[model samples]
Target: MVTINLTLNNFSELPSLLDVFGCFGNDYEYTTRGLLRRKIPPVCFICSTLMVHNGYNPHTKEGPGEINIGR
Candidate 1:
């Protein structure tokens, strides 16, 4: 299994998307041993974990210390 997490420096400035798309499929490709392999992309349901900690960031303070202080 593979998991990927991404953070954008200019995330809030992103324009609204007119449409969204998602898929749960796999790609068939030959491996080094000439055997067919299925490559699947990881699916992320909730990704907005955090940007940084400490008492900083004047923008959305989504970090654990600022936002989620408890639990």
Candidate 2:
């Protein structure tokens, strides 16, 4: 099984839809290897979990902190 593990240190973002959309922007891509990798994307583990828990549907506004995407 493949697991995408992320860690958000010092999280302060309030969350938002745009943040989620932007997360899949230019930097991110899905590979045939069944892995999602990104570069310079604004996302963290907390936000990611929130996105997944909400079915990738975030609803908050006024995001905080600089989110860094990881594998």
lDDT against the true structure, each candidate: 0.34, 0.44
lDDT of 2 by residue, 1-71 (tens): 22232336313432442354444656665454545665434444554533432234454455644677996
Query: Candidate 2, which segments miss by more than 4 Å at Cα?
Result: 1-23, 39-71
- Per-candidate clashes come to 0, 0
Clashes of 1: 0
Q: What would you estimate as the lDDT of candidate 2?
A: 0.44
Question: Any runs in candidate 1 off by more than 4 Å, and if so which?
Answer: 1-26, 41-71
lDDT per residue for candidate 1 within 3-67, as digits (tens), equals 22223753443332111111212353334454443454233235533333222233443443445
The C-alpha RMSD of each candidate to the native structure, in angstroms, is 19.0, 20.0
